[model samples]
Target: MDPCNRFRMFLVPFVMGIAFIFADVSQALALRCTALSGDDRYSILYTVQAMHQAKIQRQGALITVFEIGGGDPALNGALLYIRIEHNDQAFVWKTGLNVHSIQQLSTGPENTLDIRAKEDFLDSNNMVISREVSYKIHFYLNNDTLEDAIFVENSPKIN
Candidate 1:
């Protein structure tokens, strides 16, 4: 084989490999998320109860219900923030009710919640990458608070 032809053959594959790597990186660059749900434990005064229906929706919402009698009634009526973490990215949404006010928090059979992303974080082309992502949820007592309050739940990656 000619030397120039051999060099061309090697160069083509090398360039193709580089292109493939770039494509993978671009896919990773888009924010991807998986569906997640699990139980959250709440305690008031020495009594602890599990909030079993907690869920984080891929579209941008966290839904969970807190029963009235487990803790202080004031705790149920306070405003809260829901924080979601995916890889190094974080998104926050405000929930109108405190920990105890939700009666039936439903994410449906798929367990997906619908949440509105902030205007700054909107990406029209990136779709939620189901099952290929992992996420964590944190609850805050105040909307302006940066730190998670007493409740944090880590969910299993849904297949």
Candidate 2:
């Protein structure tokens, strides 16, 4: 085997490996917001996280989980009024929970809310996709008065 040919073969694999590493790093650099909406007295918090899962005989998939909660220093066991609208779907909840309280409207508590997209959906080189999801959250006091209204337009991409 020629010495130059051997080096060329090794170089190709090494460069491919570096590209994959950079892609992974770019994905990790994506912004992640855990705080959604809040007011002077109360707040409506949200968290979004993604995880990649492998499937048998199929391309891997990305699963995103969403968690929403109500928070206030003066809640003191007071019932909170929360309304969440995702992609025009509405969910309402009233609870006396604190900041750590998480409510999953569509799915079970253990499952929570999630959006799944193909692993290849993201364009690594471009880094500009045309996919987005919208959300609206409203926080209210036990007295039936609105505390804060949060409207998110074209939030993080789903694809």
Give each model's whole-structure lDDT: 0.35, 0.31
Q: What is the lDDT of residue 54 in candidate 2?
A: 18
- Per-residue lDDT for 96-149 in model 1, tens only? 222433223334333333221111111234332212222233343233322322
**How do all models score by TM-score?**
0.24, 0.25
Error in Å for residue 76 of model 2: 48
Clashing pairs for predicted structure model 1, backbone only = 57-113, 60-115, 76-100
Candidate 2 per-residue lDDT, tens place, 15-80, comes to 976875675454333232222333511333332121122111121111222233322222211122
- Candidate 2: what lDDT? 0.31
Where is the poorest 10-residue window by lDDT in model 1? 114-123
- Give me the candidate number with maximum lDDT: 1
